[model samples]
Target: MKRESRQTTGGQAWVVNRKKEDKKMEPKWLTERRQKAAEDFKTLPLPKTDEFWRRTNLSRIPFDQFEPIQSVTNGAAKGSASRYLPVPMMVSGELLYGEKMSPATLDPNSQKAGVILDGLQNALEKYPELVLKYFGKGFQNRHEKFLAQNEAFWQTGVFCYIPKNTQVELPILLASHFSGGNQSAAPRLLIVLDKGAKTTIVHYASSETENDSIFLNNVVEIYIEEEAHLTYIDSQALSDQTFEIAQKRIELETNAKLKWVLDIQGSKLSKTNIETVLKGSGAAAEVLGLLCGNKKQHLELYAWTQHAAPHTTADILIKGTANDAAKTIFQGMIRIEKAAQGTESYMANNNLVLSEKAHADSIPRLEIEADDVRASHGATIGQVDAEQLFYLETRGLNREEAEHLIVEGFYEDIFGRIPVESVREVMRKNIEKKVGVIA
Candidate 1:
């Protein structure tokens, strides 16, 4: 086992101690991969000068002060797994992760349909060949420092597979709960849908402690096969004193369809990347995001959609609101390759600054190589409409109530597009609470 340490300029350092027990539990191939990633993680430097990172100050984060959790014990006995139970709607399956990842439970119908849902470690033991085939296929950038760290240290995660020609009517839930202070966790997720399959998945992450300073690095990979359809919802609500970084990669094949929704609300500082590749003809994708920042929270997101085949299409809409001294940033890009002659894509980001000290930034970019493609990008940043607020105030509402109503109305469009009603309702309530509309 090799131990690596990352030193900060301030003379502080954090060490990652590789456990022999973890290496012994996996096959030789996986062990080799982890070893390679660990080496890469040590050599790869943070992209501080990169365009995506120029706006944020990386040195200010005290990464060296947090201890990386190398192992996890069962959390069920500690009463931490029940936070996500009694979900608002029925689910085909549910996977819970706290200090540890639990065994997945699936409805009989789903299991009978040849669906596979299990903890990532368990899946490696039970379905080694299947997991190995699609393990790292979706990632476009293998050398990224954060990605390398996740690949090297991830110990808790979920693996979900839907067989060909099967349709799971109810959504599946994967929930992760984090607690404690000055601790770091790296969790990974993999979801694969075979040809002509259809399913819906909700990925939710939250923290139980409100003031704990924590660090979370997460990665998710999803593959949609030919003619398959998938709806994925990713929501994050961590503690206000935490630093979170997450990356999600998705690949769609011929005639496949995808609907991706993101709801971000918590974390003292959060940076997320969502990249989708339309690899085959007729593939389509729609991405919708909602960001709500309050207090001193900083939320940032980068969404990229690549049209690599003919007749592929994509649409992205992200709405954000910042209050107090919080800040929000959104960067969106749509790329059409030369082979994607009939591609049609559009990207838009809109933001509202509710307080004088609050700030919001939106960057929309387009790169087109196909002459026949149609692509457009736009962004807008503005404050609440005084006229609308006055109208609401005249209708017997105070200024706070009026602003809350306006914010709600501003996000209604994106909320209406959410495929899961339960998730949409939960996000709505979370936003309401953030806006001080409810206790």
Candidate 2:
């Protein structure tokens, strides 16, 4: 494992930790970038007065309560030989690699397949041109305050580059965790697939400690070249005490294809943004998300797609359930530029309100500047079907059992679409526990 870092007189780096014997000095350009980002973070304050903050309350953040990690922290369970374990598998395609403890523990098979996978710092030292070219493409620091803060403080990230026309047989896993020692985290990921390359990645995230009141900020960017295909699945079950703010965006070239799935079943409060830009003709994208929130947990999700070239296509669907006093929000938008003739796009959000006090909000918007395009958006919010429950109870099941079957049937289609069985089982178990159906 190659390690690269910058040490201060305080005897540590503010971002990721490294051993004394394996330290690789930081490059001049990277050091300068880090310094500038830190300065930007200090100058840019959190957005408290913005119109975006109107729906959700941001006043509860404890800015001064937690501190950064001083040493290496790994939450791998005891007796496990590998530092990492498989968490989210179904939607994640071939090759499972995790950033459990150190960034160097890449899959040997993937390395042999000409897949370049390593920590962001290590990759920065080895591939400066590629890293710098796509670090922050469509989104700029000035576009969002939290994004700027993340750019400044981000110490740990992954860089994955797949050579042209190469296929790995196993699923690759990308994982991150917020341990007890590290209450606040900022991590980013950059993925680049050369022309004709095809790969699938399963993104899994969790908390090291069982439960801790912490904050997390994460960002990911993917660049797909012409004729390439990328399948990415974001599945995380973090502790309920954590506040998660994450964004993921993608850019696709001519003939490129992308499949994205998100399963958010944990966290006390979270706000997520996922966007895609079809920059080439014949490029296509698919997005799916499933989430469950209970008690006082709150979740807000955003998705946007832009058709910048003729013949581009995008499809999006999201389903969620809110129980107890929990709440959920989903907002989706589609944009067809004037030059993007023959573009096709559609979006929908469906939510299940299990409790009278729970609330679900859905907003779908579209901006069309193209004369030849097909686009539409829709949303629905309702309670469990009383007829279904009555039919189930009339048979052999009890009230709880009947409700459980109804809810299970509702998510059956989405769960069935996941490719892995073990992951599907785990997700089913979690949904049961969260919604009090399969206890």
Candidate 3:
């Protein structure tokens, strides 16, 4: 594949110049969808002017310099997959993606239950109808530039489907590890749980090294049918020189339940948006986020929970800590529609500024249209408490140790909410490394 030079006009010439042989092989509907997104990407402006993007600037990024990955290739080393797997032995299925996605490994029971877990390209070839039925159906942001770009140029993806009334006893793991610099990748993921299904999924994304400069724009869509349950853990620990923009959309039907955990600890600049919509009565969602930023890193997150039906409920809590000259931003919103009577929603964001040069921002909002709904929001931005530090120091701990203990305490609440012990441990270790508690 040939790399195209940056164009001053919209920086989208590369899309037109990309190879079309692979596109020609894809289904007509899929090809047409990509074509529409390509056109949309050419016209949609960078989201810097939007209110949600006002806190973070996208103008500084060299959008045209990075070469887009053209195809799926094994970007990671052989026999090195264990590093990316959260629990190698415990998972019922595993899919690893470098530039190319590996064949999924599933247990016999899961396969016999009609579960489908495979690379998106393979899934499209083998089960086009299933892929077409749910692909891009839950995404509500039609005009976002990055979302459109992913839709147009995504080279690798994971597709997982749990059949109706089937329950997977173990979690499934999807891991992506990019290995090069000066490259960009668009990876998409689709997960569908039919009615009365139950499962847990762990999605992890990272770069091979801590210093590789890359750009990653990814999208994930999830659908939970009536009475289905899903526990999703999404974690990102990319290179310090990577710029990542990610969006995850989830839709829940009647009596559906979701527990979502988001852990972000890496990337030079990361902007993530997570939206969950309760479209049926008795649907519920619980979201927990942990962000740790160090050095000159900038991490921003936007979480929105929408209650569109009566008896729906949502709870969101996000905690972050910034060290050195790092910056962190959290924006949360809870919306209750007019027909969502008996809706219960709450959102809270708390931040700890570890150094004077560090910065943190927290914004919480609530929009309630239903008379009987209970919605509230709160936020806090403060430095490490001097009294608490002193108290820990008095217990024979050094200054660094005391600060680490306090930071650990701050994140303990979020960790306790995570159902998977291994995932919690992995996140705890990452947090410790970020806080300089461990090498």
Clashes of each: 0, 10, 0
Off by over 4 Å in 2: 1-24, 49-51, 70-100, 103-109, 208-211, 398-400, 437-439
Q: Supply the TM-score for candidate 2.
A: 0.85
The TM-scores, one per candidate, come to: 0.94, 0.85, 0.94
lDDT of 2: 0.71
RMSD of each: 3.2, 6.4, 2.9
| Candidate with maximal lDDT | 3
- Model 1 pairs in collision: none
Which scores greater on lDDT, model 1 or model 2? 1
Candidate 1 has a TM-score of 0.94
Cα lDDT of all candidates, in order? 0.83, 0.71, 0.84
Q: Which ten residues in a row have the lowest lDDT in candidate 2?
A: 1-10
- How should the candidates be ordered by lDDT, best one leading? 3, 1, 2
* C-alpha root-mean-square deviation, candidate 1: 3.2
C-alpha lDDT (0 to 100) for residue 86 of candidate 1: 31
Q: Could you tell me which 10 consecutive residues in candidate 3 have the lowest summed lDDT?
A: 1-10
